[model samples]
Target: MSLKSFGAKIFASYIRKKIDKWASQPEATQQKVFRELIEKGKNTKFGQDHDFKNIKTYKDFTQKVPIRDYEELRFYVDKMVAGEVDVLWPGKPLYYAKTSGTTSGAKYIPLTKDSMPAHINAARNAILCYIDETGNAKFVDGKMIFLQGSPEMDEKNGVKLGRLSGIVAHYVPAYLQKNRMPSWKTNCIEDWETKVDAIVEETIHEDMSVISGIPSWVQMYFERLQQKTGKKVGELFPNFNLFIYGGVHYEPYRAKFENLIGRRVASIELYPASEGFFAFQDKQNEKGMLLQLDSGMFYEFIRSDEFFEENPKRLTIGDVEKGVNYVIIVSTNAGLWGYNMGDTIQFTSLKPYRVIVSGRIKHYISAFGEHVIGKEVEEAMQEAMRSTKARISEFTVAPQITPENDELPYHEWFIEFEEEPENMDEFHRILEKTLQEQNSYYFDLIEGKILQPLKITTIPRGGFNHYMKSIGKLGGQFKLARLSNDRKIAEVLEENLRKYNK
Candidate 1:
């Protein structure tokens, strides 16, 4: 191993020990984090407004501070944006992770000096954990490509603001600088397609060992490389061995990615968001990511089924049960308190507190009261792919509540296939059967004749990309929802399909 690799291995060993120490005592570590957050929060403007002075316990906190989404918290955030000091956190945020909002047009999540290390360290430790487990640190010596947003930023009130991925680009550690690909100038290009084309040219001939990005964006880069060289990714970059990704589940894209790379690679799954760096895959063979209890963020959970109730019971880490879907809430050192992250996760291992993201709170198909979530759809798709040997590029689901011929309404699945299945009817049957097995409400709806069997609408090649492009959300942390209650995305797909087929 090179000296850098040797040093990395030693450092990884050290971090593993530290992580193990805390993971073994998850609840106590969390209580310490909670106490620190509360102590630090006592002096902020928000704390005074919310009666944080009298809050002495978790129950007091619950009573003093109600859960708030971005919109609800905007009153404080707006002051921070306008250069107010100590409105949310002490002084101004070090940076603002600007992201598209749900009800509001845009959101600026604070990243303070204290909270920034959690994001950086969690990402770094994920790779270190991989090196430690696999005993392969040579990849650290090779070229590493991170397909991400432009690092360019705009300034407001002395705070740098940009996409979360873009903001993170400015903080790539010194040791990895020489090994990183797609030069700074190339990353700053505002247009994604042009930027990706430039990246293809820059890294096509490099000895790339680690390539990290969301799967959809990385697939685009891979396809461009193949088109240029007419070779599988594995052949072009023989040293490439690790694929790290976050945002969406990897199972649905596994077949297509394997076909593109021409081989399977060791992969790591990360649970990161603009709100916080939540979890990272710690073991090579583990089923779920090890939760970051010592990351300066205290976690709370509300059962997914009862999340809509007026007074849903919010449980702490010690009270949570394995396998139950819960909406993850967080109070972070970044000064976000009682923040609902809008993501649902299920604990897979309570002994070490590992979790897998199950779905989004708002992304589901429940037109007929089925309440099918992203995890179920992705699971059903995985089963169908396995049974039929089909390869899918991308897909989304929307409820078709009105049929022209007086037939019962059904869910419309818009799929873009990498390789079409030979037995279309069988593929459909597998998807339907697997979904029925996963969701009882959907099965009851079909059995009661309230809804018909789901239908598939094949999107032409590049159609989903075109749809995303048409809406100006083509790349860079943008991912299509697995399912929607309404037909907004479905109609766009239909429109793009017509344009593509012509």
Candidate 2:
């Protein structure tokens, strides 16, 4: 190897060693490490400027700071845009991660040096743990394809850093960096057509071991790959061993992926946001383990049941228990203190911190003007899937209000099935029964006949593609939204209803 490549190999080796050491630590030791980072953050310039200097412990830290969302961070971002040296973090942010601010409009989130490590380490651990679980470290011998957003640097900010994908590409050791598909310089998230073409062209002759990115985008790529190769993805990329996915739930898209790929691809669920990488799938059979970045942030959890209670209970990482749903809060080195990310999680176990993403706290659907949370929808869907004995490929639920019928509201489903059900009406009844039983409001409405019969729209193959195209969103990162159980569902459902009405 050349001298530069040799140096990169050494650096990559060092990173691997550090990651293994961190992952092998006992839960208690890991917590201590986290506490130390939180303490150090309290002393840093960011802490003082953000009112964290006086906070000595996690309790004091969370109490003094109020929970903040992306909108509040936008205030800090505006200052950064004006060239403020320090606002949220100690130094000027290297660049911002542009995220779809679904509810709050567009948001440019600060990505600082201290914060970058957390994101990188979380992602690295996800990969390492996947290898450990599958006993497939040798799969790394082949090239990995990360179907990600373009790396074009934001010219307006006078920042050289590309989006998160680009920024991560730059930080990876040079040797492995060269192995990246569609070289960073050429990939642009906005230029989807060209980027996708480039990715397909570049990987045509390469041996692929792992593929990672948003499931929607990866699915799109595989569809294109099928057309181009005239062969399924399995035939074209037989060596691919793992599928690392995040950004959205995989349940809806799982079977489709398995069908296209022709083998069971090991999956790793990653929790990444523009702000930082928070958790990842740590074991093979178990759900994702919340690997606390004890060195990056102090963690807190607000019990899901108590989230709206008169005096809701908030628990530290130390206080979390098995099987309870919680909203994750964090105080990170990058200057975010007591920030609530709005994602809901349920602990599978307490000993090792295993948790499954329940849903977004803010994202839910209830059409009868009753609150229907993500957990409710998940349970109802699970029951529906079981009752019908039908494998759901993808689905989204919304409330429909019939015109001229003021008192009647109905639930509408846009469903993609693995195989056509023998009796469509029976399938709908099973789903309706499941929903009514799972959600009390639906049950009451159905009994009173105040609610219209549930409507079902069976989508044609590639229906998600049409949906993604309609929104001008690339399939890779977008998710099917279960809009509020009220009028919001009507707006979201309208588009899908129009597309899949047949």
Candidate 3:
């Protein structure tokens, strides 16, 4: 490794030490540290000079800044796109991270130098915590493969700015960065075929230790690797130790991945978006421990019960009670004072502030008033897949309401299997039993015969391809909407269900 790269690794090591020290502190001390950061943020030029002067205290901050959705940020993004000054972040945003939302169309989130550090630090700390937990620093010594988005930098006017992943790649230790798939110079946004092909070619012969990316993309990449090498991932990349996945839940894909890799890969979950890296799974063996960037943002949680009530109350992060589901709201360094991420999460423990991501606030199917969230659905699906010994590539649930009949709405499942089951009826029976066992609401509804029987529709090998093609998004970035608990997602699934099932 070059001297510069060596220096970067040393610097990263220093950051890791600081994080470890911070993690070892008492919960009260951590809260103090967070408060200090918020105070510092309030004093920033952009903070005081902007609308943050009114947000002196946590309560004031939450009250004054109403919760904003992505639609509210669209105008600001348009201004940024048009080269307007002082809009989203403090400085001119380097590049916009293009992502889609449940309700909205394509969203362009601004990524600035100030905000980028949070994402980089969160990701780095996640890795460090993993190493500390697993005692696997030797693994870090090997080449790390990041299955990331297109590496191309966007150019506006004369200034060239890299994508969020590209900017993040800049912060990675230079020594390890050299071994990245697609090399930083490749045009990631050119086309899906070109990008996937490049990734396949570059990763075929590398000694990869840590492999990281979204589960969907990584699954596809692993399949391609198998095809190229004429061997499964375990035979091809025998040295891989850690499998870091984010952008979606890992449980559904866990068994299949383990079967292909021939070993139990250490998995880490990251809750990140174009806006920021909100939380990460601290412990590799346990569920996610959400170390809130208290310094970066003030948080609020709307109680699930209250949300369904006529008049809802918003609970501050301090007021959150353990074991109840709540929607998250944030007041961040970015111009977004209070933004609702539209995600529902429950605090598993309050002392260390660990949380279980329940589902999207909007991603639930309540046709029969059962109030089932994504978490319940996911758990059900996973249990079903396990029991039936069926490998699912992708799946979605849609509520079926019959106008002519008074029977409660039923759930229709569109499953894309890795291999067809010989006994399809047995598969369906196992799935229904799993769902009934996993969710009390589903169980009660099914036992009462309020809902119709669970309908299973198995698709051809390229079912997802047809769905993606119909939506004009057939590529690495496209992912199946896991939780269709809302109307918009239901509508999309309805259209696709008609196309595939009919």
Top model number, TM-score: 1
**Residue-level error in angstroms, candidate 2, position 254:** 1.7
Off by over 4 Å in 2: 1-51, 102-104, 155-162, 309-311, 367-370, 375-393, 401-407, 417-419, 433-453, 460-463, 485-502
TM-scores across all candidates?
0.99, 0.84, 0.85
Q: How far off is residue 55 in model 2, in Å?
A: 2.0
Better of 1 and 3 by lDDT: 1
Residue 28 lDDT in candidate 2: 56
RMSD values, in order shown? 0.9, 4.3, 4.0
Relative to the unseen true structure, what is the C-alpha lDDT of residue 359 in candidate 1, on a scale of 0 to 100?
90
lDDT of 1 at 277: 96
Tell me the tens digit of each residue's lDDT in model 2 across 285-324: 7766665545476677898657767657667766777776
In terms of lDDT, model 2 sits at 0.67
C-alpha RMSD between model 3 and the true structure: 4.0
Give all candidates' CA lDDT scores.
0.93, 0.67, 0.68
